[model samples]
Target chain A: MPLDLPNPTDLAVPGFIVLMLAEMIYGRMSGRAVYEGKDTLTSLLMGTGSVVAGLIPAGLGYGAAYYIWSEWRLFDLGHAWWVFVVAFVLDDLAYYWVHRFGHRMRWMWAAHVIHHSSQHYNLSTALRQTWTGKLTPGFIFALPLAFLGFEPAIIAFVSGINLIYQFWIHTEAIDRMPRWFEAVMNTPSHHRVHHATNPDYLDANYAGVFIIWDKMFGTFIPEDKANNPCRYGLVHDLGTFNPLRVAVHEWVGIVRDMWHAKGLKNKLMFLIGPPGWTPDGSRMTSDMIKEDWKRRQAVKEAAPANIAAE
Target chain B: MSLLQLLGSVIAVFIVAAIARWLFPVRFRLEDAHLHRELERVYPDLEPEEILIDRAGNAALLRLSGARGIVVVRRLGDKAVLRHWMPGTKVTATRTPTGLMLDTDDFTEPKIVLDLDAEGVSRTESWLALLAAPDGHAHAA
Candidate 1:
């Protein structure tokens, strides 16, 4: 059944622009937000490229999703107000898992890394959408929703709202929200940690709309900016402003690693292993990096204690 | 995505980026103190002995204090990244007519070119010698 719903993301475009302009003005006066011309341009172009990619190649994802929904659905969950609510919650849960995989699995990270390529976090940084997300298996998480008989059109609409909700959380302007809000929702504070490269903050806070998902799982890390400041970007920061490079650099990395890898097993691991995986452990994954920091902290603390005992 | 929408988005990209550039005119300049702070932030507890900056002050090499390697800092745009080039890491530091160029065995930063003058070139000669030895590891205090 063709639902006559307009894409909510499309309608929100003007709001995104206006909010960005407002944020820029606020950043100018308050010094809370950071903006660089080249960074903003790169991010916006990525967003535009994402739209284009969705229109052209993303048909495969949309097609597959609806196929499962129409033919394989358990029940014909017709349009209802409550269906939207159920779709929103279930889709968010799916997002949590998919997003977790996006960070953990190398194949998915190739598609997702564009959003994290920026060294600075602000409203513009939120505009850095993935260009090749349709190619990856990230959409598989949403397929269950389709199977559960939620219309793909409805899923599409709510998922758009999920994304829209996330945009405002990309700023540094707002500190902590109200204590109640902070506990329940993913605020700018929580999302900042998600973007940070700081060892302690890496591979954490993968929430779309609700911070509770992260808390329910073990992925939540509170924003501790006092002790350790957030340094945004990937482990190996891309030092280029070219949106093309930003979009496909990780995909290139995966191919390069696979070609150089020794055995077929190792090559497969290069694709499936966590980002920064190596056979000899020459490179540090996020987990390894975090462990290194913990080890360093222990050594530093132990040194003083040893001296005091002596 | 309509043709009109796509064209409008392209135009908006320029307008937004321009507005950002206008508001934040000056990117973070790499002064010695600022560079020191940034290096410390990236590499916690790794103290640098000397900060060797180029004439342009765009790029710098921090000779680690009582350590086995140098930390390289290069500007991306307004932001700079601090990467460690430790001993046993194959960093081919050679002097060219242009400047002292380093072929770093790093995925992100494959090559590093340090713009240098005559005096700068002469000073980097020692760095070339230190990094080029068969051992290729300089243990300094």
Candidate 2:
């Protein structure tokens, strides 16, 4: 079942390094404070771990997907031009759900937190990947693509393309694309909003290749730099550069929460609930934060009007 | 790869990470415009570029271009309080393999480990003439 196509992602490694160096040089010349020594090192280390840890699960996942395709595939969609297009589009759609749910559920977030651990958003931050994705059930989202009879190889290749496209959008170097392109594509601007911890920007813009998915799903929030400047990283920052801590902090947090939870239901919620959710109303989720912000904004807006009425 | 092989690779990665962390010796940099504003109360003329902050902006070390002393600032309340390290101040500084620790008669608590590599500590000692002399020298500030 070895799909004879070369690993596109492996070939892109040299390109990633060259682009990072170029970005670093540009950052230095521009004095943008793009890269910090410890932070960059930590990100690269995480990326290295991700690539290594990914090896075992990647093979396992491919095998599972291949098995499903061989046994249960409905249509024999041959390798035609339109088939590539269909594969690319469907793979991206699967990515959206996986990415979306990865943020929404605390269980998936335990693995996804590694990517958001870095405070600074840069090219290296793009390399900051999850080492524990194998533990999450998000890969099951792709099973539908295989069952629908798209080749696993095509799905993998298209996924690689999506990833390579996403790498460049992790930088602050590029601002916005052309109006039409920005509207349609997931450019750096839109992706910045996705990474932002700002209450207005949280849980918004979850698109891989196409911005239209977010637009259609009501998750799109345009990058508003002036009013709500994007603050990168977790709401509560991981203050240490310990690679092990960065990698496993969220997972440890989830375990700790579950241990302290009072009942079976509470423990289940701890695992499956959105982040920042607590049994008591002490902590705030993204929804709560957003609602609170809206209330405050309304109050501020009405203050002047009330004064005028007076 | 088999499960054992995968586990071995994971272990190897951790080992590599540990070695890299040891070799690099992590140091956190703290500099922001808000920090500059806080420090401005003490040194009105202090330039943000000349100041290097550490310990999550709780402590800062500054080298003024024309000034003769090393200025140390500690964040208190909402403001950063500055103290000048004069030529005659008794500053006891120690350097271990891990980091640099500086203690002075001027302050009650020791300046926490200025987490730096061996080379960075030496460079800082050279920059501050007070720490370079035999009287002020212990390891390096």
Question: Per-residue lDDT of B48-101 in model 2, one digit per residue for the tens?
Answer: 335555535556667544444566665432223456564455666688565566
- Show the colliding residue pairs in model 1: none
For model 1, residues A150-213, the per-residue Cα lDDT tens digits are 9999999999999999999999999999999999988999999999998899999999999899
lDDT per residue as tens, model 1, B1-141: 799989999999999999999999855556799778877677776788777898767788877766556777888778887787665556677777878887754555646778898788776656555555556444464
Candidate 2 residue-wise lDDT, A150-259, digit = tens? 88888888888888989999988888899999999999899999998777888988899999999999999999877877878776556456678888888887888899
Q: What is the interface root-mean-square deviation of candidate 1?
A: 1.9
Q: Which residue runs does candidate 1 get wrong by more than 4 Å?
A: B44-50, B64-69, B86-107, B110-113, B125-132, B137-141
List each model's interface RMSD. Answer: 1.9, 10.7
lDDT of each: 0.86, 0.74
Number of the predicted model whose lDDT against the real structure is largest: 1
Predicted complexes: DockQ each: 0.57, 0.04
